[model samples]
Target: MSIFSKIKQTLHLMKDIDLDALGKLSQKVDLSEIMKTVGELDDRQLAGLMKMLKHKGGKKGQHKLPPIDGDFYDMALKLSPQQRELQIKVRNFMEDEIKPIANEYWNKAEFPFQIIPKMAELNICGLTYKGYGTPDENYVMEGIIAMELARVDVSISTFFGVHSGLAMGSIYICGSEEQKQEWLPKMAKMELIGAFGLTEPEVGSAVAGGLGTTCRQEGDEWVLNGQKKWIGNATFADVTIIWARDEASDQVKGFLVRKGNPGFVAEKIENKMALRTVQNALITMTDCRVPESDRLQKCDSFKDTAKVLRMTRAGVAWQAVGCARGAYEAALKYTKKREQFGKPIASYQLVQNHLVEMVANLTAMQTLCFRLSELQDEGLLTDEHASLAKVFCSMRTRDVVSQAREVMGGNGILLQYDVARFVADAEAIYSYEGTKEINTLIVGRAITGYSAFV
Candidate 1:
């Protein structure tokens, strides 16, 4: 070929070269000198240069990631019209209202009392119960609400879980018809607040079996005396459901301990490293007198408390999914905009690997919680089923949050980046509801027919 024609062909091939990548390549090797050397070559050498240029430019197109969706499996498509509306309502409230001040409140370790009325306006408290102004929907809806609240702030979700799932639920599941009528309507309206006081300094996982707090029937009142620890919402709750052992029967019973009782003091636990916004209290009941009418008549034994745990643990699993989801979503968005080596770090193979593992674990957790709610709604849920979900989802969530922190580098640990909060809150979820060791044994007993707990 003519010399002029050869020069024109080389310029055309150079148009496809990624100059940025080529500049990086230049730093490692003599790209300018290499081009000069290439100009001296025959047609075979020129063809080889063209092939090298195309491969180095990442095969001619930018790498695209699938949309950053936590619900990778489209689980929301299964929701009914009403349920879908409820999800949207809660999600919007969380994203618009809670997301703005979540880190703010969490840093200060204070509860935002103002949001109570706003949250009540959603009419979602006591979500699954069938009477006394509750929505009476289903467990799936309840799980979705928990996830939506947690997607922005786990402390907020935990607060709600304590009031709605534990306290109100204790009344719903174990209260008599009179108790339900008197409490559920006001609690549902959010006019009166509630708390569940079960965990104590001496007992947590074994609360269902052995409680340190003692309750004894005396005349028209039951006298309760013991200390309860990690009791969320207890500090300000209008009524805190205190579970204590009935001394006469040696069985667990629930008492509606009213606020301002002379003998009930709920001191807020301070300096928490996680879920700091939740006002967990150390409650000490000294000669606390509760009327017989205030007793949860249905709770004659620890077996009744187990029913409450079985219901609430599933909500905890969903909360874990939300925490992982929030971190993954934040990391994904940050990676795409965060530039390194003259390109988005998200384009790097290792970053994508972290993201994939996160999404995979997230999707698995979401689906597992979904099925868990199904079993709950179907009345087929067991303690072991809820325990398995709590164990798996909470453990996976810790891994997901850690990877999320890794991808964000130094910013991952900072509250402004939004992922750091999840990293911290994940630790609380992993330990609460039942520790990893306790939950695993519960499942082990079910599958292996052997009690591992002594």
Candidate 2:
């Protein structure tokens, strides 16, 4: 309000820059005479003087960019405080831990085995399951966790999904009480890794129709003879849940096949372009003998297997959302920093169009996965529900990643740029957990009351 007060305020604002310089200038200029002249100025003149002083301190007029968050809908706001905390925890873990090594391991086509102990500290595995050293969280939290994990690296997401969702899910849903007690606790703690063995080289989408693998009871043990392809985490997993059709009852059954068995061998699948960081293995079982007690007690038929797939399919939908989110955010940041013709590319209308489309798709995916997860948690989820989410999200993810790549130009194709990896990984997400065509038919069957694929 006062002249001396205003000058002091101005001086305080420029303390970092002008104090020493002003002392140096005082030696040359008559500082006392200059201050007396400046005190005569009006309020507006003082304000202008303050602005000039502030400018000298730093270039503070530059526009600041918003934080890179693909969740445009604020979906996390809908989460309970606890769930939100966990979501942030998982997100920080992915960004801090996995993002650094993602490209390195992906280029080598190898899984980072060292991350297990650090990941175990998160205490998030088997998040939705109750008891057996699990979190017993809701389906929404589980889906959010899926999104957070894949938001940085889809290979790790798939690896976690195969272990926590598919493999552990199978045991949780189909195994007997004893089996769950033995395996679920250790798997939940990351002490023992697990892999799902359902897709054989010969049978994939039609595994429910019949598995190529055969299992027959011989005395106290069942003999399992078959090969499973594209089995994630199989090479190093302590155990794999092998699905085989019973030779006698013609029913699909699950067996807990431990590693190091003479009859079981897992060879890593190599030279993969997509999801390279996931250690997919070709598992061969010859006369693999397992006691009947190890057989999943409730898994009497393929319907049980379908149950596990249906639940995990929703998680896959969430993964698609994450993949698209990462690509969108990456492209958005790159475009902001990337300039062409005298202005930033992000300032161009066409480039903004690509970004808008990516955000729109990403938002749709987040909202849809939320409701899909709600249905699952509410016990109202059907195969059609999961299938529709998988069909739509995976398809939209492909489009989003493509646009992301397009916006980056040639840099989009390179691994260092990150969009290229999303482009490749999106393809794997599109094909796995049920392909687009297969999922579409599933939704068609529900609405039309007729099975198109069958």
Top candidate on TM-score is 2
Name the 10 consecutive residues with the lowest summed lDDT in model 2. 50-59
Q: Every model's Cα RMSD, please?
A: 14.7, 10.5
- Alpha-carbon error at 335 in model 2, in Å? 0.4
Model 1 weakest lDDT span, ten residues long: 50-59
| lDDT score for residue 102 of model 1 | 94
Q: Report clashes for each candidate as comma-separated counts.
A: 0, 0
lDDT of each: 0.89, 0.89
In angstroms, give how far residue 80 of model 1 lies from its true place.
Answer: 1.9
Task: Kindly list the per-residue Cα lDDT of model 1 for residues 1-454, writing each as its tens digit.
Answer: 4444445455554755668977889789986676566667776666666445434424447664455568877687567546766787898899888999999999999999989989999999999988899988899999999998988899999999999999998999999999999999999999999999888998988887789999999999999999999999999999999999989999899998888988999999999999999999999999999999999989888888888888899999999999999999999999999999999999999999999999999999999999999999999999899999999999999999999999999999999988999999999999998999999999999999999997
- lDDT of candidate model 1 versus the reference: 0.89
After the best TM-score superposition of candidate 2, give how far the Cα of residue 218 lies from its true spot, in angstroms: 0.7
Pairs in clash, predicted candidate 2? none
Tens-digit per-residue lDDT, 107-164, candidate 2? 9998898899989988988999999999999999999999989989999999999999
